[model samples]
Target: MNDFDALQAVIRRLAAERQAEQRACEAFLNALYHALRTASGPGLPLNNVTFDFTPDPAERLRPPPPGGWHAAWLRLGLCEVLVRVRRDEGAFVGEYGEGGTFHLTGVTEDDLILLARRLLRDVAAAYGGGGLVGRSGMPLN
Candidate 1:
């Protein structure tokens, strides 16, 4: 197989091996969500979480780029129901060639669910028709 195909095969294998870990992570996020809901005194689920993608975000928005940064926007919410007040918990990102990984930085389950829901929506929309969206925060130096 070509290098790209071989790399994809390896990635798929690694992903399969990590399935259990991903499930556990999801469970942990769910627990956190329940606790937040309990403390909040009742709630269904927050659909407020959003994914803002741009070829490049404002210099202020990006963390230091590692491993040849790729154009992609990502936001992981774990208790972001509070928006600018609390903060999204499980957010992370990476380049497309690098295999985007959703790093759950262990935020409240509520935030995780909210963030996941939004991401799922974004994924669906991306494949539905529109090619990957691109935007620029500031022109690359």
Candidate 2:
């Protein structure tokens, strides 16, 4: 193709790719909402469900905010490996994992402290389901 034609072709291709990515992001987010829903007030449910996510335009289509609940889940999920329990619900649901459904119940002051401490080391890994889990035994620092 001529030089001008080649440049035009490249520009067209780039535009097409960007459009595809935008559509994909939208579809994926929509599907995600229909999959992991929150059932209760002011929190995401650990139960399998669906939810609608209205992304913020100012953030350039970034996903919803990572609230405190999500942060808590990262902590508990990491500790879960060492504790040997069921799958971490809060990770997906965005709320405090149900203590009744698992070992850690009764969100007491001490429990919160322990969870925060455990997650501190491995929060970066926690995002994509990868993270370090502290040992089960309390060594007494």
List residue ranges in candidate 1 displaced over 4 A.
Answer: 40-141
The residue-by-residue lDDT of candidate 2 on 34-136, one tens digit each, is 2223212236443433233333322332222222111111112223311111113322221222211123433444543444344333433454445344365
Candidate 2, 77: how far from true, in Å?
A: 22
Worst 10 residues of 2 by lDDT: 66-75
RMSD of each: 13.7, 14.9
| Model 1 weakest 10-residue run by lDDT | 79-88
| TM-score of structure candidate 1 | 0.30
- Model 1 misses residue 104 by how many Å? 12
